[model samples]
Target: AQSVAQPEDQVNVAEGNPLTVKCTYSVSGNPYLFWYVQYPNRGLQFLLKYITGDNLVKGSYGFEAEFNKSQTSFHLKKPSALVSDSALYFCAVRDVVGYSTLTFGKGTMLLVSP
Candidate 1:
C-alpha cells in the first residue's frame, strides 16, 4: 500500500521568513507526488506535483518541491512566508504503475505570524 507522512502537525513561521513543510512518501514502482493546500472550510487546492522529469518542480503561490528519489521525500518550500499563506497543507502520493487514487498524509497546519 502507498502512504505519506507529514511528521509535523503544525509549522510556525513569521511573515517574510522562508517556510517549509516536510513530507515523505512510500509507494511501489514510480510515484506520483502532489501537494495541496486547504483553506478553512474549503477544498484542497493543487499546489504542485512531481510525476516525472526535473527533480526540482515549481508550482503555485511561490512554492516548489525537490524530489529526492533516494530519500523518498518531496518537501514543500517557499522563499517567503505570508500570513495569507497559512493553511492546512497535505502531501499525497499515488503509484504510477498501478492505481490512480491518491493517499494523503494527515496534513500540516501552517501558521504565519505577522
Candidate 2:
C-alpha cells in the first residue's frame, strides 16, 4: 500500500514571505511523488513531480519540492509567497516498482495574507 501524510492542515504566510508545505509517504518501493494545487471549486493542477533525478525538482508557479528518500519525505517550497498562491495543496505518492494507484493526503490549505 502507498500513502501520504501532510501533517499540517493549514499554512499561513504573509505575502512576499517564503512558504512550505510538508509531506511524507510510505510505499513498497521507490516512490513517485507529486504536488498539486487546487483553487476554490477548481480541479487539481499539477505543481511538481519527483520521478527520478536530482532530489530537488522545480515546477510550475515557482514551486519546488525536495525528495528525501531516507526520510520518506517530499516537502514543497516556494521562495516568495503571493496572495494568488493561496489554495488547497495536496501531496500524492505512488509506488514505482509496483502497479498501484496514487494516494493523496487530505490536503493543506495555504493562506497568504496581504
Candidate 3:
C-alpha cells in the first residue's frame, strides 16, 4: 500500500490568514514523517519532520505538525500565513526497511490570496 495520502487537492487562503493541509500515513513501527513545500520549477523544500517523540512538532517558516498515533495522521498547520507561503505541499514518510527515499503524496496546492 502507498505510504502516505493527502486528501485535499488544494487549499486556498487569503494572505495573512492561517492555513492547514491535511495528511495521513501508513507505515510500520514509528513513521518518519516529513512535510515539504515546492514552488513551480523548484525542488521540494523540507519543512518539518516527526521522527520520534513529541506529538507536536514545530518547523520552519512558522509551520508545525501534529502527529496522531491513534488516527495514523499527520496534518500540517501554519498561522498568520503570507502569500509567500503559497505553494505545492507534499507529505512524505521514509520507508521502514527500504531505501532512504521517502514516499510522497500527490501534493496539495496552498494558494494565499491578496
TM-score, candidate number 1:
0.97
Q: Write the per-residue lDDT of candidate 3 for residues 1-114, one digit (tens) a residue.
A: 448999999899998887889999987666889999999999989999998889999999899999998999999998888989989999998855555678899999999999
List candidate 1 stretches off by more than 4 Å.
none
How high is the lDDT of residue 113 in model 2? Answer: 100
Question: Pairing residues by index, what is the TM-score of model 3?
Answer: 0.92
Candidates sorted by TM-score, best first:
2, 1, 3
- In terms of lDDT, model 2 sits at 0.96
Residue pairs whose backbone atoms clash in candidate 2 = none
Model 3 clash pairs?
none
C-alpha RMSD values across all candidates: 0.7, 0.6, 1.5
Clashing pairs in 1: none
- List the candidate 2 regions with Cα displacement exceeding 4 Å: none
Q: lDDT values of the candidates?
A: 0.96, 0.96, 0.90
